[model samples]
Target chain A: MKQEIQVKCSKGNLALIRDFVNRWLDEQEVKGVLANQIVLAIDEACSNCMIHHHNCDGRSKIEVGLNYEGETIYVEIKDSGKAFPIDQYKPQAINDIIRKRNKGGMGIYLINQIMDEIEIEQQNDHFIYKFAKHLG
Target chain B: MEIKQEKQNSYISLAPIGDLDANSSLEMDECIQDWLEKGESNFHIDGQELKYISSAGIGVFISHLDEIRARGGKIIFSHLSASVFDVFKLLGLTEIVTIVKEGAEIAPHF
Candidate 1:
């Protein structure tokens, strides 16, 4: 099955993105734990796109696509915004983060941990983030 | 979704139902800040119904840790959802944030 959704690049609108993905996952019979993880990953990706790529400019748009084939689920979050530096992405040190108690730098790290694989590519005038998960 | 509040002993207990994402993160921050300003400390978020939390929601706790510490306050979470707790565990937040399971002491995290 496949589905897609478009949302305004506003933080307040992230729930719609999350709820859409979540309903799709539920229909695919993805396990609850895994589904929750996928939901967070999708949420974080869109959030990153809105906050970083679009610079919190709510006028832009974020398009999300979801597809499930057998035991694999694929999600693509696309936006017409600045491309992210995927190669240069690095998670902050956990100890330092805990000591300093900072939260700003953990979203990408959490997304990486939750999603099995991710690929970022700029196509035409939009940046597409592809994240995949394999269900057992 | 709303976060229910109560006064439990020395802790200001909060219970959130449904997901805690971007839209509600600010509300969480503001709620805690309001309590802090009102001389309420020993924060305890009852996570039984808290199914999900993104960075935006967790950021509120992290941002206020310093201020709460300075006030000799503590923040603790109880009965976190397995997936939600996994995120916290993955981030090593269990070390910094007090998370109590059933029958565990709901102690202060300072």
Candidate 2:
């Protein structure tokens, strides 16, 4: 099954994002570390949209979709903003990134580390981020 | 995020439990400012219960570093969970801020 939620890019939306992801994960009965990883990944993605993409303009919108299939959870976040340079944003190796303490660039890097798989693509003016993780 | 302040010796510790994102970052700023006005220089932030934090949150710490240093005070972090520690390490905050293993480690320095 799949669920979709649309949230506006505005302040005070992080809680809403967290609640939405947690509810979906609970309903799906995702347990243990897998659940925690998915929750954190979703939070990071939504935060990136709100902070980096929209720049807190409150004008852009983020569409989050969750899909449960067998033992895997798939999440996709689409943002209606300027295209994000996926290549430029490619995260450094975990050890290198962690050692440097690069503040602004750590979000995507952490998301990549936690999620099982991450694929980013740009279509027109929209940037799409797809993440997947397997449940135990 | 909810901030509960406790003063030990010359240090003021703010324990913020919950999400430390963009919205709550301002609240922390105000709390830090209030402590600064009271001439409280040293700070220890207990982030054990803080589940989430973002760049905006990190920015808050960076903005206050100068003030704390000018006053000859330091901000130390204690009891950060593995995930939260990853965020701090990734942002290179471990270099700029002093991260101790526990609140007790700060007592000796202050």
Tell me the DockQ of each model, to 2 decimals. Answer: 0.60, 0.24
Q: Which ten residues in a row have the lowest lDDT in candidate 2 chain B?
A: B54-63
Residue runs of model 2 more than 4 Å from their true location after superposition: A31-34, A90-103, B33-40, B48-51, B62-73, B79-106
Q: For candidate 2, what is the interface RMSD? A: 5.7
How high is the TM-score of chain A in each model? 0.92, 0.82
DockQ of candidate 1, scored on C-alphas against the true complex (2 decimals): 0.60
- Candidate 2 docking category? acceptable
Tens digit per residue, CA lDDT, model 1, A1-27: 989999988888888887898888888
Pairs clashing within candidate 1: none
Candidate 2 local lDDT, A12-107, one digit each (tens)? 777787788888888888754456557767777787778777887777789899998978888989888665554346755433433443334556
Best by DockQ: 1
* Candidate 2 vs. true structure, TM-score: 0.75
> Which regions in candidate 1 have their CA more than 4 angstroms from the true location?
A98-101, B103-110
